[model samples]
Target: MSGRVSHTVDMSVKLGELTLRTPVLTASGTFASGREFADFIDLERLGAVVTKGVSLEPWEGSPSPRIAETPSGMLNSIGLQNPGVEAFCEDDLAWLSSVDVPVIVNVSGHTVLEYVSVIERLEVEPRVDAYEINISCPNVDSGGMAFGTACTPAEEVTRACRAATSRPLIVKLSPNVTDIAEIARAVVASGADGVSLINTLLGMAIDIRTFRPKLARIVGGLSGPAIKPVALRMVWQVAGAVDVPVIGMGGITDTEDAVEFMLAGATAISVGTANFVDPTTVMRVTDGLAEFCRTRSIARVSNLTGAMRT
Candidate 1:
C-alpha cells in the first residue's frame, strides 16, 4: 500500500468578502430552511444554506403538473411558492438561527417596491447572514420582462436591493439573455457583492399521446447534469469578466462537478436538483471535497478557483 500523508486540507472559501467554511452549499428552493434534510445531514457541515424565495406576501404557486422529467434534467415552474416574509422570519429564521451555518435568504418579487420591502424587513435580522436577490422572476412592473434578462432592469433592481440592506448582496442571474457578462457587470456596478449564475435554462416538453405540454406553465426552468456544459461556459465567462466573487451553479451532482466549477472561477457552488436525489448530498460533497484535496496534495481548496489553463 502507498503511504500518503493523512494531512488536513483547508476548504474555506470567500464569496466576495464573506468567508465560508466550505465551498459546498445547497441551492435555494431545493434545500428549504434546513428542516427537510436535518435528519440526513448536519447543517453546519456545509458552507451555507440558501433558503427558498421569500416574497412580501404568501404565494399559492402554480397549478398542478408543475414538474416534468427530461432525458437528463427536469423542468419546473413552481412560481416561487413560500409563506410571506413575516411567517418565514417567525418560523424558518427562528430555527435556522440556532444552527451553526450561515443563512443566505433568497428574496423574490414582482416589482421593485416588493423586493425592497422584503429586504427592509429582513435587514435587521441577526439570523440573516446575506441576501440573494432573485431577479429572474417576471417583473410585473416592466410588462413581464425578467429583471435579469436586461442590464438596465437588472441594475435597477440590484441598486434598490443593495440600498435596502448592508449585508453582502448576491444577484442571481438568468441564462435567458443575450450577454450574461453584460448583465453581471451591470449588477456588480450597481452595488452587488457577488453573482450566482445560469439559473436554469428556459425549456419545455410535450406529451406525444395527450398532445399537451408536460407542465401546466408550458415553459419552465430546466436543470440537471444536462445543463452542466452551459453552466460551466457561463461561469467561466462571468468569472473572467467580473471582479466580485462568483457562485457557480446549475446541474452539479457530485464532487468532480463541484471541482470543475471552482476551477472555472467559482468561489463556491450551490448543489441544486441533486438534493432531491439524495438528502445527504451536501454532506457527501463537503467530505468528498476534502478527500480530493488530500489526494491531490492541494494545500487549500481556494487555490482551485480560476486555476484553469489556457
Candidate 2:
C-alpha cells in the first residue's frame, strides 16, 4: 500500500555523489543530533541528519542572553558551542548510528588547521557519511566574519578540509558578504563537494528600555521566514555560479519554501528555526513535497532543481 503512494513522486536528491532518499534535511545547530527531535520525528524519515558544529575542543558557547526573538525570526550568538569532536564521536555518533539515516557532521574551527584537525579525526569514523563545513558560525573565533566573508579564506579553508577527509565536503556559506556567488565558485574550485548557502545574516537588536543591545554579543546570526527572500536570491545566484550540488537553507519553514528553494536550484533543503516552533516540521515538509508533486503530475522532485526559467 505504501509502496504505491511513494512511487507517485520521486523525492530523492543527490548532493555531489551522495544521494538522499528525500530532499529535506535538518539545519545544523537547529536540530541538534536526533536526541531533541527523536520523540517528535522519525530520524529515518529525513534525507540526512546534519549535526551541530563540532570543533577540536569543547566550547562553552557565548555568555548569557545568547538568544533574542525578533520579528518573524530570531538572533542567536550561541557560538559553535559543542562537546568537541572526540566527545561527539563517542556520544552523539553512537546515538546517530543507531538511527537509520546518513549523518553529515557540521565541522567548525578557529583556523584552517582547527577545521582540518576535526576533519582528520572524523575521517576514520565509519558513522560519518558526509561533512558540512560550518564556515558560517557567527559567534566563533573571529565572530564568523574572518573566514566566510571573503573568497580567499573561504577557498583556503575548503581546500585544507578537502584534503583532510575522503567524505563529501559541503561548505556552509555566510550571507554577510558582497557577492555570495563569488564565494560559492571559490569553494567549489577549491574542492567543495557541495555548498550550503545563506547561513544566518549578521544582525543585531536593541532594547528600548535599557538602551543597549538585546544580545550580549551585540551581533548574532539572524534566521527565520524574514530571511527567506534573501536566502532564495542567494541560492538562485549561487546555484547558477557553481557546478557542484547546492544545498539551500535560511528560512525554510514549510513545503512551499522548500519547493521555492528547489526551483531556485537547491539540490537539497534544510529545515532550521522552524523546528523550534514545530518539532515535526521536517516530516510535514517531506510529506507535503510528495503531495505537491503528485498533484502537479510531476514525476520526480529532482526535476524541480533550478526549474525556474529566469
Candidate 3:
C-alpha cells in the first residue's frame, strides 16, 4: 500500500456572520431558486441557493431572441423577469423553506425605494438566510445607469437595503464599470456584509447570414468561460480592496475553476453559466474541493482563500 496519509478536510466557510457548509453556491438567475435542479442534485449539498432577481413588481423583461451563443460564451438580456416579491414569497420562498440549505434572495429594482421594499417584504420570511442585492438592474430614475456601475448609486441602494433588514447582505457587483473596486468599496462602506462579483460583461453578436444583431437588445450580458480571466482579475482586485468576503463568479465550471477563485481571494465561489451545460456541476465541484484539499493535506478549504503566490 502507498504511504499516503488520510485527511479529513473541513469545507465550512464564513461570510460575515453567516457560515456556509461549502464555498460553492448557485449563482442567481442560473439556479432559479433551486427547485428546478432538485431532481438532478440534492439541494442541501450546496452552500447556498441564490434565487433569481425579484423586484417590487413584476418586470415584463426584454423581448424575445434575447439569447445568443458565441465563442466559449453566451449573451443574454432576460431583463430580470420575475413574478414580483409577493408571488416569489408565496411560491419560491415557500418551497425553499423546506430545504435544509440557506437561501439568499437576489433583490432587484429600478429605484432605491424599490430595493428597500423587496427586502422589507422578504424580511418576514424565515427561509431567507441572506440577501444578495443585484444592483445590476437599471436605475430608471437615474437615466438607466445600472446601480452597481456607480459608487454613489451603489452606496445609496445598499444603504437602503441594509436598513431594511438585519440579515447578511451581499451586493452583486457589475463588471461593466470603470473601476469595480471603487464600487465595491462604496457598497461595503454603506453596510454590505460581503460582495459577489463579475456579473457578466456587456457584449453583442451579429448574424452574418441575416445581417442583423443576434440579440434583440443589440447588446447583452456575456457569461461563460470567455469571461473567466476578467472575472479572476476583478475578484483579485475587489478582494484586496474590501475587508469583507468576496463571492467570485463568472465562468466557473469545475473544481479547478473554483480553486482558482479561492486563491484569488474569494471567500466563496458561485457557479453560473455552466449550470446549463451540466446540472450536477455544483455538486461535482463541491465534492471535488474536498478531494483536492485532502490530497494536498490542506486540513481546511478556507486556507485556500487568498493563498495565491504572486
Residue-level lDDT of model 3, residues 41-115, one tens digit each, is: 989978899999998999878887988998998998888889999999999998987889989999888888988
Q: If the candidates were sorted by their TM-score against the true structure, best first, what order would they fall in?
A: 2, 3, 1
Which residue pairs clash within candidate 1? none
Residues 119-145 of candidate 2 have per-residue lDDT tens digits of 999988999999998888877656255
lDDT, each prediction: 0.87, 0.90, 0.89
Provide the global lDDT of candidate 3 against the true structure: 0.89
**Model 1 agreement with the true structure over 190-220: per-residue lDDT tens digits:** 9999999868888899999999999888888
Pitting candidate 2 against candidate 3, the one with the higher lDDT is: 2
The TM-scores, one per candidate, come to 0.95, 0.97, 0.96
lDDT of 1 at 213: 98
What TM-score does model 3 achieve against the real structure?
0.96
TM-score of 2: 0.97
